[model samples]
Target: MEHYLPSFHLKGKLAAVTGATRGIGKAIASAFAEAGADVLLISRTDSDLKEMKEELQQYGTNIYTVSGDVQHYDEIIEKIEQKKIESSIDIWVNNAGINIRSAAEDVTEEEWEQIISTNMKGAFFLTQYAARQMKEKGYGKIINISSVAGHVALRTGVVYAMTKAALIQMTKTLALEWGNHGIRINAIGPWYFPTTLTEKLLQDEEYVKDIVSRTPLRRIGKLPELAGTAVFLASEASDYITGQTIFVDGGMTIYGF
Candidate 1:
């Protein structure tokens, strides 16, 4: 039997995923490892990182864990240098983000700054650092974990929405500037998911119902469901795609109620 595939295999590749201690980021890192890439996991919690590393090791892929806040560029860069990963990072997933929900009028400057710093500033700087490495190597994949809030305003809050919107634009601009260098940049915008960040919302039956009613899929997305898209972007299957945002929102973006 002859099998012809697009070579989705990630053997010998290296992937770095931020906020990989749990939730969607963890799922993406696990998926990348299962697909054959050595994974570098990053998060702020050392204990969580250790546990996640232990769990991911069962996949038989090399795993490295770094504990640091992405908002601190120097620390993140130092950690990356310290790891001295054997292979050049083929995929960089900027999945670390924070959300502070407040009414537009009640949002404080500090709250706004925190949201922007974590979701936009940190993501930009991390991508800049990763893209530099990728540019030198002449090939790389950068996937920013954005949200449906990037496209449409959510009742979740204005500060969070603003940062997400900025991320989408940043993804596009970076893609345009770095595409010639063979560094592809794209974003995945997820809808409601039952992750640590959204656990509160999920507990609210009415809120959950409203979200489901609005979404064509009629259910919240699962963390693992995002893994395939992450792998696709990191693999040769998406070599031709760049400067785009894939909405993994189960048709929520297109649904108008």
Candidate 2:
């Protein structure tokens, strides 16, 4: 094996991915399984989790499911502790999040609270819990699923952007605080992926056209394309990397036009 090539292999490792039912989260879970990690899938729907476990079983990785709402931090922590049993949670992916697209002034208080609670508060606490476990074992990987909206004003939604930007900062801060303890923290900022969250927006021809024209790659992101970055972050290949937000957008962040 070369210097870092073998670091990409995740054989015998254990990973837990939140929001593992569909879209980016599911794709990331599948990727980790493909990389030979036993995965714990966490989602809100138990039925969906069951189906996902069936689908991911073929990857030859042990699949476990924990169902709960991420917004309910205590409930999620309890479920995770119960399901985790004696396994060391080596990798934790905070992929559970919500977005409410509204103008800054038009955004309701209720919507603001929902977005903040799930996107920011829930993920932060879960990361805290995961870090404590990781600290005990002396090593872990934490990957937070942020958004490109955090980097620049994409006009998606003001509050959504706020939460994501906070995630990026959180990644950096956690990495700084935990680096000596062997816990690595990083973030992924995706742009214009065709997930359930973007189903309605993808239907508008004008919106599609705008996305293509603005993106240097001129194509919306594919679900699988977003998985490799996550796999890399979760694996030992990223041992030297932390506190960085890798934007998985197709040149959207770098484009000047």
Candidate 3:
């Protein structure tokens, strides 16, 4: 291993990733483990969490998991303390989120609250908690999984976009507020990826074509492709980078049409 491969050596690091039971979160968690970090998986379902923990255990990395909703701050805090990982989370990833699709006019107040509760409020409080621990330890990495929808609107509607945009700003603000304490906060804005949540959209040929046309790469991203960004952000490779949202969107954000 060369020094240039800083992201490849995360040994001795401990990471906690939310929504690690599936899709992008799962990929990121597995990648972090492969890069030599002990990983703690968090999600709402215990079965899924256990399954993922077992799967990741096959990689020979230490895996811990907890089941809880990110919406309740007290519950999250309690879970963290109960797990005895309160001050041990070196890389905290706020990857759990939800998207409700509807036209702006058809969007319900309930829907807006759901998205905000998980995507914005949950992320904010969790990051705040992690930042406090990191400040005391003199180091930490915080990665928020946003979306290109944060920078560009999609037919998915306003609430999803709003929460993601808020996440991007939250990352920037936390990065600035915690930088002096050696805490680096960054975000990853992904485009289309094959996941249970996006399976319906991927099935529509016309919609798929439209997305491909807009993306310079002419295809949706793979889960693994997004993992490297998480690894880099979590490791020493990105020590100098903070308050930035790296768009892993195949150039979708830069396209006007």
- Candidate 3 on 140-172: residue-level lDDT in tens? 999999999898867777899989999899888
| Each candidate structure's count of clashing pairs | 0, 0, 0
Instruction: Give the least accurate 10-residue stretch of model 1, judged by summed lDDT.
Output: 1-10
lDDT of each: 0.89, 0.92, 0.89
TM-score of 1: 0.97
lDDT pick, better of 1 and 2: 2
Q: Give RMSD (Å) of candidate 1 vs. truth.
A: 1.5
Residue 49 C-alpha lDDT in model 2: 98
Instruction: Give the number of the best model, judged by lDDT.
Output: 2
